[model samples]
Target: MRLHVDERHERVLALVRARGSLRVADLAEELGVSAVTLRRDVEALATQGRLRRVHGSVVWPGAAAGAAPDTAAAPAEVRDAEGVVAGMVVPTLDHPFGEIVEGARDALEARGGRLVLGLSGHAEGDAEQAGRLVAAGADGLLLTCDRAPGPDSGGWVPGTGVPAVLVERAAPPGSPGADLDHVRCDAAHGAATAVRHLASLGHHSVALVLREAADADHLRAGYAAAVEALELTPAPGSPYLAPARLPEAERIERTAEHLRALAEEHGVRAVLLHGDEFAVVLVPRLRALGVLVPEDLAIVVHGDQVASLADPPLTAIAPPERAVGEAAVALLLERIAEDRRGDRGPRRHVDLLPSLRVRASCGAVLRAAGRA
Candidate 1:
C-alpha cells in the first residue's frame, strides 16, 4: 500500500532526525518513492519548518552545527584546493528570477560549488558587477540583462577571460556577446500556447494586455502568430493598455477600463495578461465595473507567481524559470572545465519551452478532464 502524505512526511523527518542529514536521492530510494515525489514531500516539510533543504540533501533544522556530512562538499581529492565559485547577476530577486536564482544555487551546491550573487539595474552595470564578483574569486559567471543585448550595448564581450553563460537573456546576431552561451525560456511559444488554450475553450476572440518590459516583445510576437494562425479576431486598440509612467492605482484603473471595453464593445471574452501582479488587481476592478470573472470575461496570466492566490485562481503560462537557471549553471560549468583542459567548443543557445497551469480564471470546464 502507498504511504499517506502525512505518513511519508513524518517518515522523512524521522529518518533525517535519526541520521542528521541525507541526500534526497538516498532518502527517496529508502522510502520506495520517486525522487520527484520525495522532493515534493521534502518541500512541504521544509515549508512547515520541520526540516531544512541544502544542496541536494535535507537536514534537521536545529542540527546545522553538528549534522551529518554535507554530501555536496568537495571530495577528498580536491578538498585541499579552492572550491569552485560562480557569480550570478540579476536585475531583481522578485517573482520568476527569485526562483531562478534558488535553482542555480541548489545546482551549484550539489556540485560542491558556491554561488556569489550581484544585483544590477541595467545592462551597462552588468560588466562592473561581473568584474567585482571575479575579483572576489568567482570561477565562472552567470549574467542576466533587462533586455536583449545589441551590437552597441557593450555589455558582455567574449574575451572577458572568465567562463560565463547568459540566463534568461540572449544577444542578437553580430552582437559582442553573440558567441556567449545562453539558456532562456521560449517566451513566444509560451504566449502562443496561451492563445491556443483560449481558442480551444471556444473563445473566438482574445485580447492581450501587457506591461512594457524586455519579454513584452517576445510575448507580442507569439500572440500575433497564434492569432494569425488560428484566424481569430483580436480586440481593438493596442495591447499596451497602461503606460508605465502612470501611478500604480491609476494604471490598474486604466487597464481595468480597457479590458471592460474589450469585453463590452469588442465581444472579447478571453484575455491573456502578462505578469501576475496586474491580473490579480485587475480582477477586483473589473468586478466593481459589473464584469464577473469567468462569466463576462476569462483571464490567463503569463507569469505564475501569486496567480494561484487570486480569488478565482488564474490559469497561467509558466516559464521554466528554475530549469533555465539549472541549465545555465550546467553550461557554465562545462565551459569552465573545457577552458582548464585547453579545449574550445562551438557556442550553444538553449531555449526551454513553457507549460500552461490550468485553473479557475480561464473558465476551463475541462479541469476534471486532466486539462488542469
Candidate 2:
C-alpha cells in the first residue's frame, strides 16, 4: 500500500471506509508518512466521529468496536477510483527496497488513492500477508515476488478480485508470458553495461560476485550475453558464493580468498559485485590480501545502497528502483480504475534501464587499460 500527509488523508478515509478500520503502523507505512503525522490525521477523523481510535487500530463508524472483519463496515460505500485503497507488500524497508515502497506511496498519493503496506520478509510468507491485506480491504495490490509461487498461490498478489502489479518479476509461467501489469529493471542491459564498462577499461575477463539466494538468473544471463558479445571468458561455475544471510568477518575473508583464486585461475581482472554493503566488506578484505582495488583488481557494485559513502566510493549500476515502485503503483492504479470502468484492455509490462555509476573503484580499471 502507498503517501504525502495532505496527499494521503483522503485515501486514508477511503481505506477506512473499505476496510472498516486500520492500524497506525500499516497506515504510516502505506502513506509514506511518519506515525506521528498519520496519528494526527486519525485523531481528526476520530473527533469528527467518522473514525474511532481503538488501541493500535482505527474503526470506522459502521464497524464494530476495534474490529476489521468484512462485515464490520456494512455501510461503507465503494467509492470511485479517486479514493481507492490499495495494498502493497514488499520484502524489506532497508536500502533499495525502501525506495520502492516510498515511491509507491508518493505515486498513490498523487492519484488520491491510499495504500496499506505489509512486509513479507521471505517467500514462504508472501502468500499469507497478501491474503491478509486483501481481507483487510485492499481494492488493488502491488507486490514484489522474490521466488516462484507455491502450488496454492494463484495469480498476482493471489487474491480473487484485486488487480495487481508485480515489481521486478516477470510473468507467463516463465515463457515471456506477461500476464499481468509489471515493472522491472532491465537486468540484461545493466549487466551488459557493467561488462562493457570493464572491457572498455581493458579488463578482458571480469567476474560477478553475488549471494546464491539472490534472484540472479537474469543477471547471469545478461553477463553471459555480454561476455559473448565481447568475446571474453566469464568466471567459471557462477560466482554466487556469498551466503544468503549477512556475511560474518571470517566468511568475508574466505570469500575474498575464493575471489583471489578465481582471479588467478580465470584471469579475472575486474569484478562486479552485489550491493555497497558487500563492496564495503570485500574492499577491506581485499586490501588485507594485498590486492589494491582497480590497481590490482577493478571493482564495481550493483545497487546504490551507500555506494557513494564507501571508502573508495564504489561505482554502481544505479537502477531506478524507486521509479520501478512508482511505476508499479501507477500501473496498479490504472488497472483498478479501468476495472471500475469496465475496460479490460491489454495489460502493460514495463522495464526501466539502469546506468553505470563510475567512481574511483572502477574508473581506475579504465585508466589502467588506458581508455580514460
Candidate 3:
C-alpha cells in the first residue's frame, strides 16, 4: 500500500532519529520512493526544523555534533567546528552547481567552519533566503544567481549585512552588487581556446553554434576575438542556434540540419558548440542526416558535463567550477576577517580560465600535421 505524505514523513523522521542520520540515497531506497520525492520531503522537514541536511545526508535535528553516522569519522577539525558558519545560496544543485557546492563544503570543513545551504530558485528570492540564513546565525554568505541583480532591484547581497562573495556570477558596473567580491569562470577565454584548438588542428574555417544562455555573450565575444586574431574564414549566418519557441526535440533536429547546411555551403570543417547536452543530441541528429562527425565536420563542446559520454567522446571546454567555489569561500573568509578587524579593502573580481579536454570528436590526430 502507498503511504500517505504525513505517514511517510513520520517514518523518515523515525528512521533518522534511530540511525542518527541517513544517506539520502539509502533513505530513498528504504522508503521505496524516488529520490526526487524523498528530496522534496527532506526539504520540507528541514524547513520545519525537524531535520537538517548536510550535503548528501540528513540528520536528526536534536542530534549532537558528529552524531550523523556518515560524518562521525571526520577529522577533529571538521567534527569540532566552532568557527564561522557560512551560508551558501544557489539556484539549484544541478550540473556545475553540485561540484561548486561540494568544493565549498570541503573548504569550509577543512577550515573548521560549517556550511549551510539555501536554495533560492531564482534571483528574486535570493535576498529573502540570505536574510533567513543570516537570522539563523550565518557569519558570512556565498551566493550564486542566474543573473546579476539590477541596481534598483533591492539587491540581496547588499542587503545581507554579513560578508558575502558572489560565485560564478558578476555584478554589472555601477550596480548595487558592484562593490561585492565575486569569482567566475572566464567563459570568453574558454570559447577562444576552443576556436584556437580547432584552428591548431588545421581547421581554417570554423563555425560557432550557441544556445542562448547567460554566458552566450561571453562565449560569442571569445569566438569572435579568436576568429579575428587567426583570420579564419567565418561560417555563414548567426551563431545562435536555439529558437526559444520550438519543442526541445524539434529544436535539436533543426539545429543539426542548420549546421549541416552551413558545413556543406561554407565548407566549414569545424564547429564550436555551446552546451554539452545539446551537442550530444545534435551529433546523433547530424549523423542521421548523413553528416559524419570529425570526418565531415569536427566539433568541440563548451560544457564538459556528460560530454565525455557522447558517441566518439566529444572534446570539451571544462570550466574550473570547483576552483570557483573554493576561491569564493576563501575570498569570503578574507572579507569576514577584514570586517572583524575593522579593515576595508578594494573589491576583488576573480576570473578563472577553463581548460580544453581533447578527445575523439575533434579529430586532432588526423590533422596534427596540417596545423598552421
Q: Is candidate 1 or candidate 3 better by TM-score?
A: 1
lDDT on C-alpha atoms for all candidate structures: 0.83, 0.72, 0.83
**When superposed on Cα atoms, how far off is each prediction in RMSD?**
6.0, 10.4, 10.4
Which wins on lDDT, candidate 2 or candidate 3?
3
Give me the runs in candidate 1 sitting further than 4 Å from their true place.
Answer: 1-54, 58-82, 122-124, 366-372
Q: Model 1 — TM-score against the truth? A: 0.81
Residue by residue across 217-290, what tens digits does model 2's lDDT show? 66777878999999987676556557756547766887788777767666677887866787888888888887
Superposed model 3: Cα runs more than 4 Å off: 1-82, 122-124, 148-156, 368-372
Clashes of 2: 7
Ranking, lDDT, top scorer first: 3, 1, 2
Better of 2 and 3 by TM-score: 3
Clash total of candidate 1? 0
Per-residue lDDT over 117-174 for candidate 1, one digit per residue giving the tens place of the 0 to 100 score: 9988755378888888888988889998775556855355454678899899888877
Clashing pairs in 2: 1-87, 1-88, 1-116, 2-30, 2-115, 3-31, 3-105
Q: What is the lDDT of residue 246 in candidate 1?
A: 92
Off by over 4 Å in 2: 1-81, 122-124, 148-153, 156-159, 172-178, 245-247, 264-266, 364-372
User: Residue 137, candidate 2: how far off, in angstroms?
Assistant: 2.7
